[model samples]
Target chain A: MLEFIDANCRLGRGPAPREGAPNTTEEILALMDRFQVRSAVVYHASAQYAEIMASNRRLKEETRGSDRFFMQWAVLPPVWDLFPDPEALLDEMKQNGVNSVRMFPAQFGHSMKRYAAGALLDTLAAHRVPVFLPFDQIGNWDALYELCETYPDVRFVLCSPGYRCLRWLVPIMDRCPNLYVETSNFLMHNGFRLFCANMGADRLVFGSGMPEASLAAAASQLLLSDISQTEKEQIAGGNILRLLSEVAL
Target chain B: MIGENVLRGEPFKGVFIFDIHAHIDATSDFELTDSSPDKVVRTLDALGIGGACVSSILSIHADCPLGNLHVKEACSKYPGRLYGYLTVSPYDPDTDLDGAFADPHFKGMKVHAAFHRTAINDPRYEPYWEYADKKRLPVLFHAWELADVRHIAELAPRYPDAKFIIGHGAMRTWEIKREVVKAVKHNGNIFADTTVSVAYDGAIEWAASQLGADRVCYGSDIPFYDCRHVVGKVATSRLSDADKEKILGENAKKILDLP
Candidate 1:
């Protein structure tokens, strides 16, 4: 089986964790072992429900001494000095070994538009840090297209596009080279083969959407897909590995 | 035991695998990349699935006559490999399923109340429900909520001979799933499929323990979604091999009478 580095995962129990959802590091590690995930990039759910800074600090503390887990901080737009200074934040991330960041614009009640997130986006682009954006938070494809086009240097991984987003995804992907898609719920039939054929395997990354979803569903798409072994390897963990490595910060 | 094959990323061998909820062609909402019957069968062969019970996307969405024609022709082309679901339209309540049922390949009825804009228990669906009861057939519903489960619970007692399957049974929220368990527990004829894009961790295990292994069936919603991952979800669950065997194929095989 191909090794997987789950690019989308969440740590810590949310305000309303679903039944059978794993919250602790021990539980997640067991799931990882069973599902053939070598490692994972995760964010703290408390960052969504509580203060982002404190939750991110808790995430770093909780995941300390675990090489198998990589931390991804939840960031917000710098409105009313809501977040730390961009340079200072990047420096902290670099020191703490946090390479990627996720944004929850809808949940945080902020706009990812130029006026709100332009400064943060520019800083992220300068450092070459990849941003994980949920599909629902961006509202629609047009906003996503604009965000990608505006920050041509930054890498964006669109998560939870679902099985029905293919018609909308193809054109957007064609226009935005900086945009990539996670494989958690992109479950269109024969979609992996078709995507690799059209978009190249480099643009796709494997993500389990674990806890909320399972790892086997996304992992099996690459494992049983008609794509070549090398392509499968790229999608399973190679692509995300390359993205994280490109983070200059 | 079957999980060993799935864990090693190999096609399941020495066991029968059949998907009860699947579609043959593309829907209006999105393209299915390859929804042709040949491709569908090819996928089943690749995954070592013995067969799949499919309804045409066209049949449920629009054009029932033409859609049923597509299903009939596909079943003819691949005799035992593909089975047909005689999809009935709510608008055409007077539609005759007798002609469709004449062929042995036509196994059951598939109802999509969401698409047809009619409640499952509406007066128009009573005739079809009666028909399924008379034939002792399994009726698969495109149900994803508590209300749908409630409707099935109410109807299952009235139509004792007919089997009721709730498609996308693990959808939406955990509360809905708990309610689904409560409803299925009350109705012996009611069963649910482990088919949802959001295949949550331990969902298969939870469903098996709550609903009993026999009351749940394996369904992939194939072409709309792939079977491999959902198969992986069931195969790699914490449930015993016997329970996994039941969910992966045995339960569905018993329901469809496939040997």
Candidate 2:
């Protein structure tokens, strides 16, 4: 068995309640232990549906003592003056131990094209900090294509893309070297192997989408995939580790 | 990194795994990665699955009559390894259910209400349900919503002899899953399969805790989904080894009367 570093997990509560127990930090840690996940790159679920800064503060507070957890912050449009200066926000992120940032433009009611995301994307690109976007929130491949074209230096990770999105996702991988996708709900047959063949194993990251999604299923997908052991290790934890290492912050 | 070995090695090595929901032809109009029965059997062999109850995508998506022929062919090609499910659309008036069911290869019937553009409760399905009930055949519905579960709720009591295996465990929401658990609780003949439903965390455990292990069966939804990932969901779940045994093969064997 290989070590897993889940790239798409959440802490705190979302607006819509889930069926099982609340997604608390203690619960997630237990889940990580059960699934043999050594570490995780996590975002606060409240950030997806509630106030961004408050959620970020809560995430930092909850994960303060644990070295096993890597924090990912949520970003709103700069027009709201959420963070007055983009550079200052990066500095704040560094101080707070934030390794990556995520965007929920559609949920937060904003656009992520070069026009709306220009400043934030530029700053993150300069810092080499990765940006995580859900496939549904990214609108369409054209929007992603434009963003990838505009900020070629920025590492854009598409979170939990489904099997149907493969046709377009393949082309996006072909067009953008900086673009990557996380494996959580990626249930396509021979998907991991095919993705590694096309984009290289380095571009595919492991994600469990804990609480809401199965860690065992996600880990097994990469583990049992036709890809080589080295490829499995890269997808399991090495890829995300490399992405986090590249972050100047 | 050192538990059950979900990677490389056979995860269900000693376990008798029986995949209840699988397809022989293309699953969707868009793409069918490995539709050949030989490929399906090979994939199953690699993952340590003893057998699979397969339907033809041609029957579900295109022509049921033609697809059922492919089902027969797959069963003949791999005698004990592959069991057939006669795929039928209520809209296809020419569908000879009796003729298809007459084949010993076919163990049951598969209906996809979403693709057929008909509700399961529609009068058109009455004949199929009635026939299936009389034959004591297991009917696997593409049940992904509460209404689909409602369809099972409506028909299960009426045709008590027919085994109703809700496909995908009504996968869309927790509400639907609650209904599925409720339906299985109320009806002894009602069951759920672990197809696309495995994506949800604790789904199998939740289902087992709520409906008992015997009411749930392992289904790969292969070609559309993967066997390794689907089986891993059950293998790695919090359910007891005994309960896991029931879901993986024992329950299916009892339902399908497999040796």
Candidate 3:
């Protein structure tokens, strides 16, 4: 039985169109241990799913002492009046061991295409890091990828990119090798087959998107997958280790 | 007994225990477990369940159309053992809808508006309200707090002909308290479920008082919440055994119009 890496996680927030009962951190970890989770990229949730920086704040508070946790990605202000200089924010994220930031434009209500490209392009240029975005919204992704190629300095980390999204993105993976895909939203059987067949397991990384996703459910997918153990290890934890270590302090 | 505490399932003395609100997702990314329908049935059978009512993973997306369809097909194979609530997002564009809700196999309907990004009174979904009324079927809607209470209030009275089950009645946070008070005041067709996993102290008691035991139902919120956990807590609450029995099974049977 191999331990898993959860690329996406949300906590400290409450309900949505549907809400789960409130769960404390200790309650969450007990569920994780049932699945044998080795690492995770934790985020925070409140009324606004990704509107606030609560995930970042919670990451510092919860995982301050534990090395088993890593702050993968966080939602931040769109380089606006709240945050004028994104470099400082990037610096702050880097200090907290967050190399990437996950963003949701549709749910967040501000299309990244509208304001994020320039600020994030500049920030990534200055900090030389990746800006993680939801996988389905293609407009932002195409815009971000165009910027990444143009800048050649910044990287784009796409989280929860579904199997269909990956298939749609096959044409550009070679062009932007700097792009990394976290397999959180994709299921074990379907996502496993798609990533193994089309994207190749090397570009594929394992992430359960825990808390919101359980380590057990995520781990079970790999356990049930027909793929080799080598591919499983890389997707489960090894790939994340390599990707984040480059940006790790 | 199952609801008496965690890790404590109701003792089986040749009597079957059925949890109507139980749900399971095999490959769901959220903290959901993968007890596939096969595994789910087996687990339940092992726990001395004659049958269990279930839902699916499509709540996170509009996939409810396919998810429910798949679940119904899966339910057909189980027939007597696994009953299902045809999951619907009020805003699901693909709801072949009539065929789905009217399907002979599905026990009833479930509405997760929060996932669908619509409020209960959103006129775009009047079609569902009309259909549910026509079928004389009860629909379970996830109501987390006061905002939902207001939303439910508007819809419940308007559909005086419809039977509505209010989920999470105990932990009315935000405006849930205000919303629920207004709802119960205006609508007599409203029933609440004691599945508010956590709101604060006395939330469950308050919800039971406000909604009335007859108006409250038992739900485990299977995938995100837990069946065993809810069973233990509610069954052991300060309520009378009659109240506990009503919440644990009787209420759901009545709301769902179970045979």
- Best candidate (score: DockQ): 1
Best by TM-score: 1
Once model 2 is optimally superposed onto the true structure by TM-score, how far is the C-alpha of residue A46 displaced, in angstroms?
A: 1.4
Candidate 3: residue A127 Cα off by (Å):
10
Consecutive 10-residue window with the lowest summed lDDT within model 3 chain B = B2-11
For A1-249, candidate 2 gives per-residue lDDT tens digits of: 678899998887765555553267887788788777899998888878777877887887777578889999998668766554688788888888998989988888887766777888888888999999888887888888887888899899998787667767778888899898888878776777667776788888899877677787887777777778899889899999999998896
TM per candidate, chain B: 0.96, 0.93, 0.82
Tell me which of candidates 2 and 3 scores higher on lDDT.
Answer: 2
Q: DockQ-based ranking, best first?
A: 1, 2, 3
Q: Identify the CAPRI category of the predicted complex in candidate 3.
A: incorrect
Q: After superposition, which runs of candidate 1 have C-alpha atoms over 4 Å from their true positions?
A: none
- Model 3 superposed RMSD (Cα): 9.7
User: Which regions of candidate 3 deviate over 4 angstroms?
Assistant: A9-35, A42-62, A71-131, A134-141, A144-155, A160-177, A183-233, A246-249, B1-106, B109-136, B140-259
What's the TM-score of candidate 2 when only chain A is evaluated? Answer: 0.95
Computed on alpha carbons, the lDDT of every model, listed in order, comes to 0.85, 0.82, 0.59
Report the lDDT tens digits of candidate 1 across residue range A1-249: 778899998888777666665657778888888878899999988886898998998887666568888889999877566678789899989888899999989989988877878889889989989999989889998889888888888899999898888878889999999999998988888888888888889989899887787786777767778888899889889999999998898
